[model samples]
Target: MEEEKISELKDKLEREKALLEEELSTVGERDIQNPDDWVAAPAEMDTSESDPSEQADAYEAYGENVGILHNLEIRYKNVRSALTRMEEGTYGVCSVCGELIEKERLEANPAADTCVAHKDEEV
Candidate 1:
Protein backbone atom coordinates (compact mmCIF):
# COMPACT_ATOMS: atom_id res chain seq x y z
CA MET A 1 0.00 0.00 0.00
CA GLU A 2 1.10 3.56 -0.68
CA GLU A 3 2.37 5.45 2.34
CA GLU A 4 -0.25 8.17 1.87
CA LYS A 5 -3.18 5.77 1.86
CA ILE A 6 -1.68 3.92 4.78
CA SER A 7 -1.44 7.15 6.68
CA GLU A 8 -5.08 7.99 5.99
CA LEU A 9 -6.23 4.52 7.01
CA LYS A 10 -4.10 4.66 10.13
CA ASP A 11 -5.76 7.89 11.14
CA LYS A 12 -9.19 6.45 10.50
CA LEU A 13 -8.38 3.30 12.44
CA GLU A 14 -7.08 5.26 15.37
CA ARG A 15 -10.12 7.47 15.44
CA GLU A 16 -12.39 4.44 15.19
CA LYS A 17 -10.56 2.68 18.00
CA ALA A 18 -10.97 5.72 20.17
CA LEU A 19 -14.66 5.93 19.38
CA LEU A 20 -15.10 2.24 20.17
CA GLU A 21 -13.40 2.68 23.50
CA GLU A 22 -15.62 5.61 24.34
CA GLU A 23 -18.75 3.67 23.43
CA LEU A 24 -17.55 0.68 25.42
CA SER A 25 -17.07 2.83 28.49
CA THR A 26 -20.68 3.96 28.41
CA VAL A 27 -22.12 0.45 28.73
CA GLY A 28 -19.12 -1.57 29.85
CA GLU A 29 -15.82 -1.69 31.66
CA ARG A 30 -12.45 -3.16 30.75
CA ASP A 31 -11.27 -6.22 32.60
CA ILE A 32 -8.66 -5.36 35.22
CA GLN A 33 -6.50 -8.36 34.39
CA ASN A 34 -6.96 -8.17 30.63
CA PRO A 35 -7.19 -4.66 29.27
CA ASP A 36 -8.26 -5.98 25.88
CA ASP A 37 -11.34 -7.66 27.36
CA TRP A 38 -14.56 -5.85 28.23
CA VAL A 39 -17.54 -6.75 30.37
CA ALA A 40 -21.05 -5.38 30.29
CA ALA A 41 -22.18 -3.15 33.11
CA PRO A 42 -24.02 -5.06 35.80
CA ALA A 43 -27.80 -5.25 35.48
CA GLU A 44 -29.66 -2.57 37.40
CA MET A 45 -32.21 -5.00 38.86
CA ASP A 46 -34.20 -2.32 40.60
CA THR A 47 -36.95 -3.30 43.01
CA SER A 48 -39.45 -2.09 40.39
CA GLU A 49 -42.27 -2.16 42.91
CA SER A 50 -41.92 -5.96 43.11
CA ASP A 51 -43.39 -6.22 39.59
CA PRO A 52 -42.18 -9.20 37.57
CA SER A 53 -42.64 -7.43 34.26
CA GLU A 54 -40.44 -4.56 35.33
CA GLN A 55 -37.71 -7.00 36.41
CA ALA A 56 -37.94 -8.71 33.02
CA ASP A 57 -37.39 -5.35 31.32
CA ALA A 58 -34.23 -4.79 33.30
CA TYR A 59 -33.00 -8.25 32.33
CA GLU A 60 -33.73 -7.53 28.71
CA ALA A 61 -31.72 -4.35 28.83
CA TYR A 62 -28.89 -6.23 30.42
CA GLY A 63 -28.98 -8.85 27.66
CA GLU A 64 -28.93 -6.18 25.00
CA ASN A 65 -25.91 -4.50 26.55
CA VAL A 66 -24.14 -7.83 26.81
CA GLY A 67 -24.74 -8.50 23.13
CA ILE A 68 -23.47 -5.04 22.24
CA LEU A 69 -20.36 -5.51 24.35
CA HIS A 70 -19.64 -8.85 22.68
CA ASN A 71 -19.85 -7.33 19.21
CA LEU A 72 -17.63 -4.42 20.18
CA GLU A 73 -15.11 -6.78 21.67
CA ILE A 74 -14.94 -8.77 18.45
CA ARG A 75 -14.46 -5.63 16.38
CA TYR A 76 -11.86 -4.40 18.77
CA LYS A 77 -9.93 -7.64 18.36
CA ASN A 78 -10.10 -7.44 14.56
CA VAL A 79 -8.96 -3.83 14.47
CA ARG A 80 -6.13 -4.53 16.83
CA SER A 81 -5.04 -7.50 14.76
CA ALA A 82 -5.10 -5.36 11.63
CA LEU A 83 -2.95 -2.71 13.23
CA THR A 84 -0.49 -5.37 14.27
CA ARG A 85 -0.40 -6.73 10.73
CA MET A 86 0.33 -3.24 9.43
CA GLU A 87 3.26 -3.02 11.79
CA GLU A 88 4.46 -6.38 10.49
CA GLY A 89 4.22 -5.16 6.88
CA THR A 90 1.59 -7.76 6.08
CA TYR A 91 -1.52 -5.63 5.91
CA GLY A 92 -3.84 -6.07 2.90
CA VAL A 93 -2.47 -9.52 2.15
CA CYS A 94 -4.88 -12.44 2.10
CA SER A 95 -4.09 -14.60 5.08
CA VAL A 96 -5.56 -17.66 3.38
CA CYS A 97 -3.99 -17.55 -0.11
CA GLY A 98 -1.11 -15.13 0.47
CA GLU A 99 -2.35 -12.77 -2.23
CA LEU A 100 -2.71 -9.02 -2.10
CA ILE A 101 -6.26 -8.21 -1.10
CA GLU A 102 -8.26 -5.87 -3.27
CA LYS A 103 -7.94 -2.19 -2.46
CA GLU A 104 -11.70 -1.81 -2.48
CA ARG A 105 -12.03 -4.56 0.07
CA LEU A 106 -9.46 -2.93 2.30
CA GLU A 107 -11.16 0.42 1.93
CA ALA A 108 -14.43 -1.07 2.98
CA ASN A 109 -12.91 -2.94 5.92
CA PRO A 110 -9.40 -2.07 6.99
CA ALA A 111 -9.40 -5.09 9.23
CA ALA A 112 -9.92 -7.45 6.32
CA ASP A 113 -6.97 -9.87 5.95
CA THR A 114 -8.24 -11.87 3.04
CA CYS A 115 -9.57 -11.43 -0.48
CA VAL A 116 -13.24 -11.73 -1.39
CA ALA A 117 -12.75 -15.35 -2.37
CA HIS A 118 -11.40 -16.30 1.03
CA LYS A 119 -13.61 -14.05 3.11
CA ASP A 120 -16.21 -16.59 4.20
CA GLU A 121 -13.58 -19.27 4.72
CA GLU A 122 -11.34 -19.70 7.72
CA VAL A 123 -7.77 -18.49 7.63
Candidate 2:
Protein backbone atom coordinates (compact mmCIF):
# COMPACT_ATOMS: atom_id res chain seq x y z
CA MET A 1 0.00 0.00 0.00
CA GLU A 2 1.11 3.50 -0.76
CA GLU A 3 2.02 5.68 2.22
CA GLU A 4 -0.98 7.93 1.49
CA LYS A 5 -3.41 5.01 1.35
CA ILE A 6 -1.91 3.51 4.49
CA SER A 7 -2.31 6.81 6.28
CA GLU A 8 -5.99 6.99 5.24
CA LEU A 9 -6.66 3.45 6.40
CA LYS A 10 -4.88 4.13 9.68
CA ASP A 11 -7.18 7.09 10.28
CA LYS A 12 -10.23 4.97 9.51
CA LEU A 13 -9.05 2.20 11.82
CA GLU A 14 -8.42 4.66 14.64
CA ARG A 15 -11.92 6.10 14.19
CA GLU A 16 -13.41 2.62 14.25
CA LYS A 17 -11.40 1.73 17.34
CA ALA A 18 -12.72 4.77 19.17
CA LEU A 19 -16.28 4.02 18.15
CA LEU A 20 -15.97 0.40 19.26
CA GLU A 21 -14.58 1.48 22.61
CA GLU A 22 -17.46 3.90 23.10
CA GLU A 23 -20.03 1.24 22.24
CA LEU A 24 -18.30 -1.27 24.48
CA SER A 25 -18.33 1.14 27.39
CA THR A 26 -22.10 1.52 27.24
CA VAL A 27 -22.76 -2.22 27.81
CA GLY A 28 -19.56 -3.43 29.50
CA GLU A 29 -16.54 -2.51 31.58
CA ARG A 30 -12.89 -3.35 31.25
CA ASP A 31 -11.95 -6.18 33.59
CA ILE A 32 -9.62 -4.97 36.30
CA GLN A 33 -7.77 -8.29 36.40
CA ASN A 34 -7.40 -8.46 32.64
CA PRO A 35 -6.99 -5.13 30.91
CA ASP A 36 -7.73 -6.66 27.50
CA ASP A 37 -10.96 -8.32 28.60
CA TRP A 38 -14.37 -6.67 28.77
CA VAL A 39 -17.17 -7.90 30.98
CA ALA A 40 -20.83 -7.02 30.47
CA ALA A 41 -22.24 -4.58 32.97
CA PRO A 42 -24.90 -6.25 35.04
CA ALA A 43 -28.37 -4.79 34.80
CA GLU A 44 -29.50 -3.03 37.95
CA MET A 45 -32.58 -4.66 39.45
CA ASP A 46 -35.16 -2.46 41.15
CA THR A 47 -35.59 -3.71 44.67
CA SER A 48 -38.92 -1.99 44.86
CA GLU A 49 -40.26 -4.36 42.24
CA SER A 50 -41.17 -7.50 44.16
CA ASP A 51 -42.98 -8.97 41.17
CA PRO A 52 -41.39 -12.15 39.80
CA SER A 53 -42.19 -11.04 36.23
CA GLU A 54 -40.26 -7.81 36.67
CA GLN A 55 -37.26 -9.69 37.98
CA ALA A 56 -37.36 -12.04 35.02
CA ASP A 57 -37.47 -9.09 32.62
CA ALA A 58 -34.36 -7.59 34.22
CA TYR A 59 -32.47 -10.87 33.90
CA GLU A 60 -33.46 -11.17 30.26
CA ALA A 61 -32.12 -7.71 29.56
CA TYR A 62 -28.86 -8.62 31.22
CA GLY A 63 -28.56 -11.66 29.00
CA GLU A 64 -29.07 -9.56 25.89
CA ASN A 65 -26.41 -7.13 27.04
CA VAL A 66 -23.97 -9.99 27.56
CA GLY A 67 -24.50 -11.12 23.98
CA ILE A 68 -23.95 -7.64 22.62
CA LEU A 69 -20.85 -7.16 24.73
CA HIS A 70 -19.34 -10.41 23.51
CA ASN A 71 -19.65 -9.34 19.88
CA LEU A 72 -18.30 -5.87 20.49
CA GLU A 73 -15.33 -7.25 22.39
CA ILE A 74 -14.41 -9.50 19.47
CA ARG A 75 -14.46 -6.64 16.99
CA TYR A 76 -12.50 -4.43 19.34
CA LYS A 77 -9.74 -7.01 19.66
CA ASN A 78 -9.57 -7.49 15.88
CA VAL A 79 -9.26 -3.78 15.31
CA ARG A 80 -6.50 -3.52 17.89
CA SER A 81 -4.62 -6.39 16.26
CA ALA A 82 -4.90 -4.67 12.87
CA LEU A 83 -3.50 -1.48 14.33
CA THR A 84 -0.57 -3.40 15.76
CA ARG A 85 0.07 -4.99 12.38
CA MET A 86 0.04 -1.59 10.76
CA GLU A 87 2.71 -0.46 13.16
CA GLU A 88 4.73 -3.57 12.32
CA GLY A 89 4.46 -2.86 8.58
CA THR A 90 2.52 -6.03 7.90
CA TYR A 91 -1.03 -4.71 7.88
CA GLY A 92 -1.85 -5.73 4.31
CA VAL A 93 -0.27 -9.18 4.30
CA CYS A 94 -2.39 -12.30 4.64
CA SER A 95 -1.43 -14.15 7.79
CA VAL A 96 -2.33 -17.56 6.35
CA CYS A 97 -0.76 -17.35 2.88
CA GLY A 98 1.78 -14.52 3.21
CA GLU A 99 0.24 -12.67 0.25
CA LEU A 100 -1.06 -9.19 -0.17
CA ILE A 101 -4.67 -9.00 0.94
CA GLU A 102 -7.02 -7.77 -1.75
CA LYS A 103 -7.54 -4.03 -1.71
CA GLU A 104 -11.30 -4.43 -1.99
CA ARG A 105 -11.31 -6.79 0.97
CA LEU A 106 -9.27 -4.32 3.00
CA GLU A 107 -11.60 -1.53 1.93
CA ALA A 108 -14.59 -3.55 3.06
CA ASN A 109 -12.91 -4.54 6.32
CA PRO A 110 -9.90 -2.54 7.40
CA ALA A 111 -9.17 -5.11 10.08
CA ALA A 112 -8.88 -8.02 7.68
CA ASP A 113 -5.68 -10.09 8.11
CA THR A 114 -6.09 -12.53 5.25
CA CYS A 115 -6.71 -12.56 1.53
CA VAL A 116 -10.12 -13.53 0.14
CA ALA A 117 -8.86 -17.03 -0.70
CA HIS A 118 -8.04 -17.71 2.93
CA LYS A 119 -10.64 -15.56 4.57
CA ASP A 120 -12.64 -18.53 5.83
CA GLU A 121 -9.60 -20.30 7.28
CA GLU A 122 -9.09 -20.27 11.00
CA VAL A 123 -6.18 -18.05 12.07
Give the per-residue lDDT of model 1 (tens digit) for 33-79: 99988999977887747889888898888899999998888888788
Please give each candidate's TM-score: 0.89, 0.94
Scored by lDDT, model 1 comes in at: 0.85
lDDT of 1 at 97: 95
Residue pairs clashing in model 2 are none
Q: Model-by-model lDDT, in order?
A: 0.85, 0.91
Model 1, residue 75: distance off in Å is 1.1
Q: Given candidate 1, what's the lDDT at residue 17? A: 86
Which whole-number lDDT from 0 to 100 does residue 72 have in model 1? 87
What value of lDDT does candidate 2 attain over all alpha carbons?
Answer: 0.91
Q: What ranges in model 1 sit over 4 Å off?
A: 47-49
